[model samples]
Target: MKFLKIILATAIVLCIVLVATDYWISHKAEGYLYSKVADIPKNKVGLLLGTSKYIATGGINPYYTYRIDAAVALFKAGKIDYILISGDNSHISYNEPDTFKKDLVKRGIPENKIVLDYAGFRTLDSVIRAKKVFGQYSMTIISQKFHNQRAIYIAKNFDIDAIAFNAKDVTNRYGLKTRLREYLARSKAFMDIVFNVGPKFLGEKIPIG
Candidate 1:
């Protein structure tokens, strides 16, 4: 009975820690998130965070589509001179950066204006690599609000000047799952900061114009 009570207490403490971390990250990022293209400050590079184009059920992921739309809008509005796609390429069949680049080009963005980082296997990697690998100390991050908040928090710790353009969010059951996952992710991010965790791969620098 005592062991069970201890387990229950531990669970409660963890839940509180998770919720607090989530709030802290989002609050830290409040002033940096913009929903409108006209309101955001322009940057030389817009870092489009990557996700799979399709969900596991074989439907187009709204997160992917909305991020692409946001990136295109930012480019056309002259808010960003280049689109740097950062995503995972861990598997031979999975190429997030390439997929995003193709979609952005199809949506009227010039191929030359898009840059790809094939090592952004995690959000931490994406945020840090923007500076360490891509030579961008300041950038406009493009993703959903929840994701942007976490990324901005990471950026601030790394001494990168970053703001985020919020992509249209998914509102279905999947969205709820993603949001719940984000709470844990935010907690992990806080711990990552505390421990000075870094990108898994930091290769030769690639300058972005």
Candidate 2:
């Protein structure tokens, strides 16, 4: 009887801790999303980080199109001058930056105004390398709002002048099940930063300028 009571108590306490930590991380991310999307300056450089795919319908994922669109909007709004496409290139077969470049070009964004980083193997790698290798201390981050919130959080922590141009969100029309995992992902992203987690791979230093 005493062991049963102790087990119940442990479970309850763990639930409380999980809820509290999740609440705090979610709230912190809320502030970042709410503030970062506004007041983007005219004529600043912009960065369009990669997503899971660049070939799915809606022309290579709504996230990719929206990111390109956001950068284009900033350019038309006179808020940015150049766009940097960064993502995984650990192997020749999996080329994210190239896909980004091709799509942006197809959308009429000039090739000369875009640069590619083929070594950004993950979110942390993209943002950090954008600063360390690409020399972007300040720039607009373009992606879906939920995803951009994480980017904004990382950028702020890294002391970059990062704002967001939220890409369009694909609805739960397919099924709400997809978003269900975001809860855990959000929590993990927070821990990833708090714990200073390193990327799966960090290739040789690439040029920034």
Candidate 3:
């Protein structure tokens, strides 16, 4: 009975510690992203995070639509001069950067003002490479608020002056799942920073000039 009690106590303590750490990390990142367009400062480049246009249910992904919308608003408002679409392109058939470029162009954004990072397989990769590979020291990040917070955390670690312009967020069950997953992601972000994890692939420097 005593052993069981001790085990229960340990588990409870672990849960409490995890929840508190997750909250702290998110709180630290909140100050760097803005939901309102008027609050964000102008930057030469906007790092538009990538997501699949279609969900598993054979429907268009709301996350993808909202992010593109946010990126468009930023460009039209003159808050950002260029956009850098970054995402996983490990497989030729599933190219996120290409998909984003097509949608952005269809929205009347000139193809010349957009750049693609085909090797940005993850958020950490995108944020770090934005500085090391793309030569962008400061830029705006576009994604949902939860995602943007985590990206901003990674940016701070790399000494990149990054801020996020939040895209519209889905508020249903799907959004809840994303928000919950973000807690675990926040913890992983801390570990990645401490261990100094670098991007999987950073080819020849691609200056955004």
lDDT of 2: 0.69
Candidate 3 or 2, higher TM-score: 3
Q: lDDT per residue, candidate 3, 48-99, as tens digits?
A: 9989999889999999999999999999999999999999899879999999
Candidate with best lDDT:
1
Q: lDDT: which is higher, 1 or 2? A: 1
Residues 48-163, model 1: lDDT tens digits: 99999999999999999999999999999999999999999999999999999888889999998999999999999999999999999999999999999999999999999999
Superposed on all Cα atoms, the candidates' RMSDs to the truth, in angstroms, are 0.6, 3.8, 1.7
lDDT of each structure? 0.96, 0.69, 0.91
Pairs clashing in candidate 1? none
User: Candidate 3, residue 156: CA error in Å?
Assistant: 0.6
Candidate 2, residues 19-107, lDDT tens digits: the string is 66556655555644422334655435677788656444434455566676776677666676788787878777888888888877887
**Which residue pairs clash within candidate 2?**
42-78, 42-79, 43-78, 43-79, 43-80, 133-208
Best by TM-score: 1
Regions of candidate 3 where Cα sits further than 4 Å from its true position: 1-14
Compute each candidate's TM-score over C-alphas. 0.99, 0.76, 0.93
